[model samples]
Target chain A: MTASRKPVPKPTPDTQPFWDGTAAGELRVQRCAACSRHCFYPRPSCPACGSGELEWITASGRATLYSYVINHRPAPGFEDDGPYAIAVVELEEGVRMMTNIVGVEITPENLELDMPLQVVFEKRGDMHLPLFEPTGAGL
Target chain B: MKDAVVIAGAAESDELGKLPHLSTLQLQLGSARNAMADAGLTKDDIDGVACVGSPIQIAHSLGITPAWLDGTGVGGSSFLFHVRHATAAIRAGLCHTVLITHGESGRSRVGAARMAMGPDSVLGQFELPYGVLGPTTTFTIPALRYMKETGLTHEQLAEVAVAQRRWANLNPRAAMRDLITVDDVFASRMVAYPFHLLECCLVTDGGGALIVTSEDRARALGTAKPLVHVLGTGESADAPIISQMEDFTSSKGFRLSSAAAFAEAGISHDDVDHVMIYDAFAHVPIYGLEDMGFLKRGEAGAFIAEGHTSPGGRLPLNTNGGGLSYTHTGMYGMFAIQEAVRQLRGEAAAQVPGAEISVVLGNGGMFASAATLVLAGHRG
Candidate 1:
């Protein structure tokens, strides 16, 4: 049986490079040259310094679990997956993004706050989606 | 505009909760008409309108051409922002009278527009792809972090719902009126980890509107309806993304907005008699009390668990049961204001006795924006 389709990220012109980097197995985020700080969920100008002079940098792909929820009801495309972890992880560079935590059991005992996690890409539809896995992530 | 602007009229839709018969526009118009009637005025008196929906459409249907209009759809708190903006406009001679309305077919989705954005939108790109559905998952993200940092027990979080339910039991209009215990909260379905079904808010269909006009105009009406003054108002926005909120334990928007309003009104925590903090989830009021400076950081959970905010508590809060037991349309700020107006008018089903000063704190997006209103029954 064919698997139920899930949501896939459609990259815009501004975010096409980030998607391209993900497909090539590198996590990318924008760093502002003006303020020397990083930004995520790519946009035109820097959020901190309002500088359009931003450059894409390959991130370390290392993040710590900042916060998350175990969603009981899955999104439309995620019918196959049971209750899953929807996480907000703070990157080593100090920007945060919403992604799913995979590669471990979805239990309170298994997922701990501030636990170390590393990014991994999972292909869905025609795009690669970034997800996280626990490095030593247990309470 | 302290004591210069007053809510001359305030009301909810003719009937709230599961009104498949009423479309969103119908709900909005019905409430607006009721508010004008309560004010002893008509559409001809309204020269300004504000709402999350199309103000032009509402103005045209109401048969009044507004001199000023605002379609600020920041979030639930957008109505609070409207009151603030209307106060400024009246003081600036932009408009003398304003009507602010809210209606959401949240449960039935009657005439409610479905919003869809392409992959380029911030949320579509960062949040949607991760199998996140809606507020149940997104707004629930910060609780774990808050608990971790402040050591707020899961029971304290559950107690927020229980306390609100106590108020709901007193109000005839509240949707969920059955008295519930913290264990009942724990036993209710787990919509998300660290959040039980009871800890979440009720999803009901409703609408509310307010009529704001100059104090002179309100007095000239000669109607005995008590005037609820717009003493001080403040609006502010913070994180666009929930994950980006500066702090997990408190809302920056709430802090700034309420602080500004209180400073403008020249009052301290001792002066407030009632409060209606928008409670989309149980944890929100816990965040609201602390962030608004009613209590120190990390003190709200215990304060609530101690019965300080329940019926007859020292500081009564959410007397209309709040969004938890009260009606929660998709955007809940309008109802919060409506309750404050009711308490000020001595008309609330669960009225706080001698509630002269009512503070309504509104939350917009997923902790992204906030607007605060300090309302007084009489000039201080």
Candidate 2:
């Protein structure tokens, strides 16, 4: 059977910068200067203090696996990626990002709270999406 | 401000469960007609139609061409928000009667390709890349966080599932009336950590409708005995993405909306005789109760365990099985309102006795938005 192609996300103007940074092998997030709070999924204004003064800054791309779940059933395009670990990674900058955990098979026995991970870009049709692989796995 | 009332009627399509016979459209039309008949009116009386997911198309299918149409699709709470909007429109003399409806074959074989684009479709670009995915997983994170913070064990959450199931058994129209226990809840497959299959809501093919009209018009028609007054309504939005919330343990939108609603109703939490909280998932009511000021932070688990929310308790919640056991036709807030009205009218099959003041809380969009309505029984 032919493997279904993976699904590609289309970025909008509000989120283009974040996707662009990922393609360049850099993690970017909006930090509000007024409230000094880091935000993700870029918006027009700061959610914390409702400040329009925000700027994109490069992140360290280091995060800890806050929580995750293993999806055994894959979607149409994600058949080969079955049993993948979908995790919520809390970046060192205090911003949490949702991404897949790669480089290791996911099992309840293997998964631990606060596992350190680093971002790795996966190129998909002119877009390099940011995904995290466990550090020291030599990905 | 305006004396807006649920004057006309309400009805559910089929009893909750697997409905292979009807499509979403069929369910919508069936419930819409029932509501009109119950109101002693016809489709021509519906000048405004508000709904979620393809309201215009559904209206056209139902042969309804409204002068004012609001297709504000805010998930489960869409119906309550529609009530608030419809109330304003009716007060402004825009439309005489408005029909708010919802239906979904949640268990249907319709693939994601045919699914309508949601407000969060943009999040798929960045958030879905990491697999945040559907409402179940997204809601699970906060539920887990709530568990961690409140010392609520997995069993306490199960109590909600067990209680709602018990209520469903009394409800003839409930989808899943199988007697469930805390063990059943915990042993059920884990859709996400801290959320078992039993703890989640049913995916049934059903539809519900509510007819909103002016107080004067309602007294004129005089079909029903007791008039259920729409005391107040409030709505607020949170972060569209669950990850962006300031705290997962609490929802500010719920808190704000409830405060506004309570203030407008000229009542406090203590005055509420019954509450019909949307229970899409077990934790939703936990968070909702806390946000609605029924319990202190981290106290919902203990409050629920104490049987405060069960039948004959201090607060009779989800008296009609709730979305957890009753029909969860995608958006469930309308059903909550229907139950509230039934309780106030003393016509509920499992009616909370002497329920004069009832509060209905509607949650939509993964704890993203909330709408609260306070309904009081008419005192002659």
Candidate 3:
């Protein structure tokens, strides 16, 4: 594990594929073979139907900004990322995830609700963390 | 609608503020002893022991080898669930008397253990790596979205801190009791966007405990204080991680738990005279008020800003100053329940006149779980 400001995730048997997909610059989610609903944070069984027949599917890498905050206080591993926008994005696949909003200045004026966003990957030793940036500046 | 279970006694570990000398276990033992004494019972009489942390350790240290033990760790709301479980356990003859305890050295870090999210856990892998810190960082996401959607202003959020301080001023036990204004709240340092320093809960070291028993057993003891009956209780859980919350603008856990509790209690909003909503942050109460049906959606911010939740308001909420101004030792549900008991007993520092019914709500882990209890002064 490289010494990063944030803690690195150690992939488990159930979540390895999700992490592997991120490293390959693709957002991966589990789809219940029975329910056909997408699930983020990969699990062995489908959350909606509780079926063991699960399949990994690539996400569109597009999302809508649901909610966010500009954290003024620095998190231990994210001291440099302080005053950054921590956001919850609703993926096009209907799943939501937490990520940082980058490629724009961290300010209230720059961040807007329901804004279009696209996923971008950053390399952190042995892992590629997914983050989001506005599709077009303030669009 | 007779209450089957009653709260025999309730007490906190020590003073509200910092106490560097006491360890977490010491705090637990102190409050447990105080609760037992308040209930007019000895350790030998407690057949059940339940807590959020280390029931066996608390039981051993207190020399109580309970026939029933529950160490359900669901966050601050764990204690409320403990009471709910204790109620059923007592009625079913699983135990005669149940004692629940909570203690945390949040400020002093005395006897505090470092908790690590398992690297393989969803939180450790997906959320933690993104620098989504503790509740303070995670909670801001929903609060910001709530403001955008609900049109709640920063001043309105500030009003939550101002109103709670008014209640705290009347209580000597409150941690920050010097009257604060909406302006003061805005002037205070910002922890996260839309959250002023004062808008957040005070990090104090403290613990609270509750003693519960069957209605018959409570009557038999005949303590001077009126028995606080457990009329109804509820518990629910959502995704543990903040990012995966079912809804960003509202809490499904809060809605489900309070609804179940109110339904079981068979009471409408009018019957509630007093309330205690866990205020780990200023936004929490707003969420509680709206989701619990005391007010409609997007109405709590204005309701609180208009002084509805204050002392002179129609509904007396967080009479103990809440986690925002009172003591918050990480998990704040126990203290909320303590205040509800006080109101029902008519012994609270800022007592609500003729307060016969009290509703106490507790939230755990960034809206991950919620528990509500409808307590009454009498059997009905």
Candidate 4:
């Protein structure tokens, strides 16, 4: 890794609870009370219905790889790593998110679209980043 | 408002590829001056200004002030939105003549604004912490999913570069002119998975500017430069982050923006004589071709690989080499607009014969926004 520090996510007043869930070993997303729909990357208003009434809920942590690119050029804190996979995964609740794929060799042969995966948190600076890995027993 | 606004002046910076000596402000002023000169006008003639950055600074630098100003900086496609906005402003009598300028030292990093995002911002909180780089990584994320669902092979993806190179070879100002095959593209350095270095756009230092005025004003001035009529314009936005996009296989912004432009132009797909889809990456045009209603899904791959968009083809595309082979200084929409005007005026280096109408499609911020323009040589 480069001597430069990695960027850390500073939670906002709206997103602090979501970050709190991650620190407690849970993946949390918002469910719009008005529309009864789930949303990721937690926000104040529902995208589907535009309602301000939202509730936090612990997610199943199950997802499938929707798409990704194996970046040959690593950002800071990934300099030591040769090439890494940055992915977007579709959750069981139908919302999609951006995350790093861990626990597998970064290659097209190893990573296929729609492959089963589960979220796992990794400590980065002061934040717990939710990274994904191939599904295994008890995941 | 059909043919009510005409492009009286358009020009790129004095030089495009690399200018380490030039600052961002210099690039902007240089191109702005060249465009005004091309229109046979002085600083006094320009009563309005528009650009991605502050219009006041540009106006003050040129010793001119105006009643109209637009600072719609929505990534590389901002210039297309400016063209569309200027058309509306001119027809509404809010501005007589509008000048849009774009300048960036992308490669040189000379006096360019630093890339910054708040830690609590949507992208900063969710995407950036995961080691997501700039466009090279994020913009390319959707290709694998698109390929899998549509059966678009890797070789076919490389064909996008090969086709544009053919057009680049015919233009002297193009940065990359040599003919390249699919094999050559694969042999090129890999920047991101499913995206070779050849498939990504160039990061060069350059700028471009445009001058839009009413048709009556052009007639009154009787300028010698050819006038390219603004037949239609449209603009729209989608999810800010790439992962939050409505659909992975297509772009909502592209579909909506292009449809509005076509509707306003009152022309069928058959009327378009030439095309320029902003190719920030090779897959972008594929998304554009299908989203813009030119072809059905799962068919654009074959259409491009078959040489339909190449030089001498029925629907010639990116005749000025595009951002891929030509100069792409950060915001590339201005360059795309410049090419359409050139083609319509029959003044392009790789001129298209009998071309009366041309369409330009632009994408901004990883499909986050889009704008489309339909232009013609004469009043239609």
Candidate 5:
């Protein structure tokens, strides 16, 4: 007998754009036109300058691992994905994104500050989530 | 602005750990009533009610329509924020007496529900995805980094846990009053690297409340001597996301908040006699002490090891056992203030000698929001 899989979170209206962008194999973040600063998590206005004029812009999909931790214990829904590497990626666009580090073994020996990375997508049914993988150190 | 004072009272429902008998509302009400009585006041006298994630609707259950109702839900720091808000309200004459309350069944309520964040919430989509479900795991990352940078050994961090537990033994209300040693801490199960199970704080079902009023009203009531004055209050926000912080090894919000508080109080870190720092995790106070200028940068481990923050040290901290061994009640800033008051009144179960000026530092949400409050006993 096989165990059933847990339900994945669906993208709500507030987060649909972000999920939609990821499904199209693109990384997009909200950029405030007034302040010309990029922001994350899709806000109506720029938190930096409080400008109401904001637009979604394609990102370089490149970043560095700012900080991370290897979760030894699995969450309830993510039992199969135990000991996953969760990271906070500082995007080249100057916005910090929380994503999982994939395509590499997560260990203190492997994980280092300012490690170069690039965005990748993992599909779960209709949803496509963005994950990051280490890229060779180069600008 | 007029002088705002903690004229009323403060109380906790229970110490840290599980409490199956009482509901969240019961704990809140119990602590609220105790605080009211401590201030020699009653429910009728309260004009404001503030809480974080309260099951009992504030105005309806508490039977008070506060002119100022702040249900700003910042875990562990909400009560301190409420105190700051209550002070402003009292100065503006909006309310004479304000009740700040909090309660949590953390042990039992774990994994019971999903958090719902508003669209404007910085954490709405940013944090939920990365499996940063709780504060403990998120905080551990930075703590581990701090240890690596400062050469802080596990034994040094364990000293904080052990010291707090020793203080807990003096208070009958404390939960984990059993003596814990540095060896016991290092030997405990590893919840996360650099954070043993003993190094973490208790997730308990408990509640706390504080009553705030004008200084004149406190003088009229005349219940307790050596009034603990709210000398100054300061609050600040760093990046909402833990990753965006300028420095993981330190708290910028603590520096900003403490600077403003000390300046407003017309005092320096050297003037502080004792401290009631929010100790949700052992590293919080370590970082807080450094950020508040109480200790030099990268010296918190040695500062704690040298017995500066221990009992009878230069600055005895968390004398009421703190959140580590005492009641956590979700947002623990109010309890820190409560402990500071107890020490000022010479009423703490583990009273620090000559504790006239106490500093209370509060951390609200994920090391993002912080508030500092200075309380001084009237010399006259």
Candidate 6:
């Protein structure tokens, strides 16, 4: 039964800001002060330059479908949601993150490489999980 | 050659596919005894111990007092890394004979500790929230990316499974030796988009062990088993998570490890007589072939579809049926190495005629780590 429970994010001081931003309807990321590069899965220091002076910045909320698959075999917690799109989107800020693609049909024909996407937030308990939707899906 | 380190002995546990009577520790000990018996050595001869699963338990249970120990648990490929490190340890005089073992009850799950992708782990924090739990889900991203970039089709992926089954048909020890067709692969249930059930590795309970020692010692011992020399070895630890890979279409760790091994071996792709690319899934070999420099970009899927690597082809890949048709005890690396040694020794059931050199490449974690080894029948 423990495996059936949905997983939630546990935030540390280094990653708290990104979670807070998600709750506030913004996509937050880190930029290295020394190297002028961006990173995701927020950390205390820069991965590229190893500098401890990383500053938080709001992302453009823009991304593109790097790649994805419609998982027919759902995990225990996601038993009702079969054949859903598990996607990795490359953001405009030069980093990629794994997320689910929603607000459209989850099929190979509907999902294409380099398709534009936008960020959306879904609340799971106290955590606001970030998901993506196709750009301009509806009028 | 820098220093000659050969596989003095190698073996599988008492039985594979399913062993309800044994725990993972028992499997390791069983394999250790078999390998030591095959090598004509005793516990006193083993001065080093290395394993991906419970090195301490193996040493204690087997009554081995090793002066050197390596417990590198990278993934399936950890054994290849063990070989790499054992080679160095032998040359450095840190140990005389090294024993590397692998044991996993992937099917029976007996005495196997429950592994939860906890909320505190990095993957659990970033990707688990999205309902990604196993390799079947996480690996889908890269498989899709490869398909898009190479214009590969679903049928092409099925061809990989079909060809591997052809090789499996010749292997009696193979778990699913019944011949499969591309149609059969397509007909199988889909776990993820483009990945059919047949395309995935067999979940089985088994284990294997290997003994590495200086060439002088091996020759001195004079075991009847063929001497498979370790001509080259390489390992690379890349990102810890799948989402952090340098690119979705290729594995940087595979490239780095293969390149290092090839450079150390001082051989070209043409010199390889046999290969075992870890086929935990169909796409894995496609990545392994291209990333290991055996094929160019966007060519493995088609090359495989054309049967270039199957039996009677110019190159024989996964002669043991690979993890696809062969037994995959969670970590499939040791099995690949065992096959390469068999091919090099001219002792394999699905043997490649006059095989001189065999290249074994293994991927660990979720495309996060890799280790490669080039084995030769004789010192090259």
TM-score of chain B of each: 0.98, 0.93, 0.98, 0.98, 0.91, 0.98
Residues B168-270 of candidate 5 have per-residue lDDT tens digits of 9888888788988889998887665556778777777777778888888877767454567788888887767676666878888889989988987888777
Q: Candidate 1, B175: how far from true, in Å?
A: 0.4
- Per-model TM values vs. the true structure: 0.98, 0.90, 0.97, 0.98, 0.88, 0.98
**Greater-DockQ candidate between 3 and 5:** 3
Candidate 2 stretches greater than 4 Å from native = A1-4, A33-36, A48-53, A65-73, A76-84, A102-117, A122-126, A133-139, B54-65, B109-113, B116-121
- Best-fitting candidate, scored by DockQ: 4
- Once model 5 is optimally superposed onto the true structure by TM-score, how far is the C-alpha of residue B115 displaced, in angstroms? 3.9
lDDT assessment of candidate 4: 0.90
lDDT of 3 by residue, B1-380 (tens): 44389999899986757989998888888999989888888898788999977899988999987999999888889999999999888877899889999888888989976766777788888777777668888866798888988999989989999999999999999988999888898899988887889989989898989999987887787654679999989999988888888877789999999999999999999999999998999999999999899998899999998988898899889988999998999989999999999889989999999999999988989899999999999866
lDDT of 2 at B331: 79
**Per-residue CA lDDT of candidate 5, range A15-102, in tens?**
6777789889999998998989998767678889999998888999999877676766554455677666667788999988777888
Candidate 1, residue B335: Cα displacement in angstroms equals 0.6
Using TM-score as the measure, name the better of candidate 4 and candidate 6: 4
Which residue runs of candidate 1 sit more than 4 Å off their true CA positions?
A: A1-4, A136-139, B1-3
Measured against the true two-chain complex, the DockQ scores of the candidates, in the order shown, are 0.81, 0.37, 0.78, 0.88, 0.32, 0.80
Ten contiguous residues minimizing lDDT sum, candidate 2 chain B: B111-120
Give a tens-digit lDDT track for model 2, residues A1-139: 3232554677788888887898889999999999889988788998789999999999998988776656544545566665666667889889887777877777755666577888888886667878887788754
Lowest lDDT 10-residue stretch of candidate 1 chain B: B115-124
Give lDDT per model, in order. 0.90, 0.78, 0.88, 0.90, 0.76, 0.89
Residue B8 Cα positional deviation in candidate 6, in Å, after optimal superposition:
0.4
Off by over 4 Å in 3: A1-3, A137-139, B1-3
Model 4 residue B346 distance off true place after TM-score fit, in angstroms? 0.2
